[model samples]
Structures are given as C-alpha cells and as structure tokens.
Target: MATLLHLDSSAFHEPSVSREVTAIFRKEWEDRHPGGTVIYRDLAKEPLPHLTADGIVSALAPVDSHTPEQAAAAALRSELADELERADAVLIGTPMYNFTIPSTLKAWLDQVIIVGRTAGEGGSVAGKPTTVVAARGGGYGPGTPRESFEFVTTYLEKVLTGMLSLDVDFIIPELTLAKSQPQMAPLIDAAEASRAQAEQDAVQKAKTLAERFAA
Candidate 1:
C-alpha cells in the first residue's frame, strides 16, 4: 500500500486556488489507487517553528541529552524524519507568496531537511518522491511577462533534489488572479486548464513508475 503525505501551505482555505487544484489532483490520485492512504498536513493552520541556533546544535548532538530543550529538539527531528520515512509519496500544495512559497511551509521544510535524516553530510533524500502543486497569481512559465520570476521552481527543484535526493514533479497554475478580474478570466482559464492537464500528465507518469517498481 502506497502512503501519500499531502501538505497544504496556502493560508487561504476554501478559496485558495492552489488548494483547489491540489484537491482535484488528490481526488484523481485516490480514484486511481483505491487502497492508497493520504496523510494531510496543513502548514498554514499549524505552523512549524523555524530552525533556531539551539535547535541546530541540539539536532547535531548525540541522543544523550540532559537539558529539556535539547531533548525536545532531538525529538522534533526524529518525529519529522518518521513522517518522511512512513510516506511512499508526498504532495505539496503551495501558493506563491512574494514569488516564493509560504513562510510557514518554509519552516516545515527546515524541520524535515535535517542532516542525518532526510539527507546525510553528503546529501540525499532517502525517502520517496515529492510532487509540488504551485499556484501563482500571474503568468510565470517559459515565455510570459513574469517568466524571469521562476525562482520558486528553480529553488525548489535544486533544494529538493540536491539536499533531499528526492524525485520531484512540479505542476504550476499560472495567472491564478485572472478569474478575479473580469478582463482576464479567459487567459487565466487557459492557464488553469494547462495546469490541470499537467496534473494528469504528472500523475500518469508517477503511476507508471510505481507500477513498474511494483512489477
């Protein structure tokens, strides 16, 4: 049985465009795999703490901890690692805030990307595949006005691949703000449609890889 860890970072709930698209993808995934289980984590609702200097030191410390803070930090690292260890796949719903992911989500990333857990001193994500669903308010793909504003995708791929050693699949919904403006719905709709198409394509790719691995 494949276990999927579903993470949502958008502060917006029902109306969050990113979550909307991710929800669709989640439904499709569940339908395709009837017995698959999904573990949902909402970063916006339950924000994770950023890595503190003390936390770093504690994480590097041996399990023999006398201080309460050190013990807590060590426990936190282990818990986060266990989450990744238990999951067969990960799905992230991200809203582009300030041309990047939400701060809360970043906090969670800090916790999970621990040096001996998700990766070692050499670096590798010894877990499973991670799929990201990114939502942007404006056009920011290959050749749009905001094409240069692709820092989010570039940074995400590099960090997830370089630091975590995880296979990544990205699906971006561009021009998400278009529908809110009467003059831009058509353009946004087109972008959204493309995003939806990409989701299906990515899912199919993942399913193929999964089946091949099972075989």
Candidate 2:
C-alpha cells in the first residue's frame, strides 16, 4: 500500500489555510487508496527539538563512537529518515511566519535531513514526490510589493530539492488574512478565489500521485 508522510506546522490551528489545503489533498489520496497508510505529525502540538551539534556531528563518526547525547540525536535522525524512506509521498502544511516557514517545520527539516543519508547524492528519498502547502497572510508573488521578501517557497524549494533531492510542488494560498484584517477587505474576494484554486489543485495532485503509486 502507498504511504504518505504528512506534516502540518500552522500555529493557528483554528483557521489555517495550509492545514485545510493539505487535508484536502490527503482526503483525495485516501479516497483513491482506501488501504493507504498515512503518517501524520502536527508540529505545533508536539514540536521536535531544533537540530543540535550532536545530531550533525554524529553523522561523521561510527555509531559506537557517539557519546550519549550524540547517540540519542543519531537515533532520532534515523527514525525520521526511516519514515521518509518508507513513505511513497510527502506533504507539508507550512504557514508563512515572518516571511518564512514556522520554526517547528524548520526543526522537522533539520532533523530529517542527514548528509549522505536522507540527503545528498543517492539520498534515500531522492526524487520522491513532495507537495508543500505554503499559506501566506498577504500577497507575495511577483509584481507584488513584498515579492522580494518572499522566502517561504524559495527556501523550501531549495532545501527540499537542492539538498534532499525531492521532486517538489507547491500550493500557495496568499492573502489569508484579508478577511480577518479590516483594512484589507478589498482582497477578501481574491483570497477566497486563491484558496479555492489551491484546494482544487490539491485534489488533482493527490489523485494523480495516488494513481501513479498504486499502479
């Protein structure tokens, strides 16, 4: 059966666009594969520890040579990597926090990426399909005033593709705060349209991947 590693890192669980979009994708995928396995992690609820020196350095030495701290770090890294390796696909819900991804999501990336293992050439998850739902409070695409400040998609694209060798796609729903912020009432309609498109895209992507993997 196909397996998906799904993660959500939105701090505001009550009204989170990224989380909703990812859920749409998951539902479509589950509909396609009733027996599929999904490994879910709500990063905000149970955040992983930030990557530490012990974790990085542990990759350099023999497993037996690791100190107690390094041993623990290495074990955690292995567990995360194992999950990624077992997954047939990956999905991440990351709301833009200060123009970038949430710290919890960053922590998950840090722990899951290990040089010459989960990352680098011949990485365990190389070319694996990954879908990222990047929700932003405001418009940040090209031609926008804050386009230069947009880092969520750019940064994740680099890390997930350049470092981890994953085949990545993104579903962006911008201006998520337009409805909540009175001053941006003009953009509420646009926001709604963008969100609708994102959900549609999510369903399409999910079904396509599910069919491909199930074949």
Candidate 3:
C-alpha cells in the first residue's frame, strides 16, 4: 500500500486556509486510493524544540554514548528523516504568515533536512513527490501588492527539490482577503473548488510518475 505523509503547520486552527485545503486533498486522495495509509504530523500541536547549543553539538557529535537529551534529539532527527524515506508521497499544509511560512514549519524542516540523510553525498531522497497546499490571506501572485516577494513557496520548492529530489506541486489560493472577492459562503465555495481541482491535479501527477517508474 502507498504511504502518504501529511503535515499541517498552520497556527490558525479552524480558520486556517492551509488546513482546510489539505483536508480536501487528503479526503480525495483516500477516496482514490482505498488502501493508502496516511501519517499525520501536526506541527502546531506538537512543536519541535528549537535547536540548542548542546543539540547542535550532539548533531555534529559522533554516534556514541550520548546524553539522554542528545539521544532524544538525535532520535527525533532520525525519525523525521525516516518518515521521508518511508513515505511514497508527502503533503504539506502551510499558510503565509508575514510573507513566510510559520516558524513551526521551518523548525520541522530544520529537523528533517539533515546532511547525508535528506540530502548528501550518498543519494538522499532522490525520487519523491511532494504536494504543497499553500494559501495566503491576500494575493501573492504576479503583479499583486504583496506579491513583490514571499519566500515561503519559492524556498520550500527549492529546498525540497534540492534536498529530496522531490517532484514538487503547489496549489496557491490567493486573494482570500480581497475586498472585491465574494462573501463568506462564496469564498468558502471558491476555496473548496480550488482544493478539489488541486487534489485531482496532484493525484494525476503522482499517478503519472508512478506509472513511469513502474514501466
């Protein structure tokens, strides 16, 4: 059975655009692949500890009789990396916060993107497909006011692609905060429609990759 790793990093619980969109993607994916298993990681709920000096030392330290804290930190790193190795697909849920991703999500990335694990000299995560459900309060597309720059989408795509060799796909739900946009009902409807279309697109993309590999 295929394994899908779902990660949600939005701090805004129910009103979170990223969370809602990702839920749609997950449901549709499950519907399409009955036996697929999904592993959920909620960064907001379970935050990873910030890297400490000792932790950094431990990370650079050789694997030996390490302290309990060091061992635990190391284990967390290894576990996160292992999850990537095990996953057939990864779904990332993120919302722009001040033109960047939530700190919690970046922290998680720091944990998993280890040298010689997620990427390194010995072929790390060379072929994985990752889908990102990204949403913003305002428009972030070309020619928009806030579109001048945002590092969240571009950075994630670049880092994930380079570190994991992941075929990245992104769904950007823009203009949610636009006054010209419709009311709550229509806004929700539009978001739902965008999510539906993105889900189909992601599945087709992954299926095509799978077919190519199988061939």
Query: Each prediction's Cα lDDT score?
Result: 0.76, 0.94, 0.75
lDDT (Cα, tens digit) per residue for candidate 3, span 1-215:
67778999988787776887788767766766667678899999998877665556667788796788888888888888888888888889998888889889988888887776677645467767788988876646777566677778888988888776777888787545543455544466555566566566655655654444341
Which of the two candidates, 2 or 3, achieves a greater TM-score against the reference? 2
Best by lDDT: 2
- How many pairs of residues in model 1 come into backbone collision? 3
Which residue pairs in candidate 3 have backbone atoms (N, alpha carbon, C) closer than 3 angstroms, thus clashing?
none
TM-score for each model: 0.87, 0.98, 0.83
**Candidate 2: misplaced stretches above 4 Å?**
none
**Worst-scoring 10-residue span by lDDT in model 3:** 206-215
Write the residue-wise lDDT of candidate 2 on 9-34 in tens digits: 99988888999999999999999989
In candidate 3, stretches whose alpha carbon ends up further than 4 angstroms from where it belongs are 179-215
Clashing pairs in 1: 124-164, 125-164, 125-165
Instruction: Quote the lDDT for 83 in model 2.
Output: 92
Candidate scoring better on TM-score of 1 and 3: 1
**Which of the numbered candidates is closest to the native, going by highest TM-score?**
2
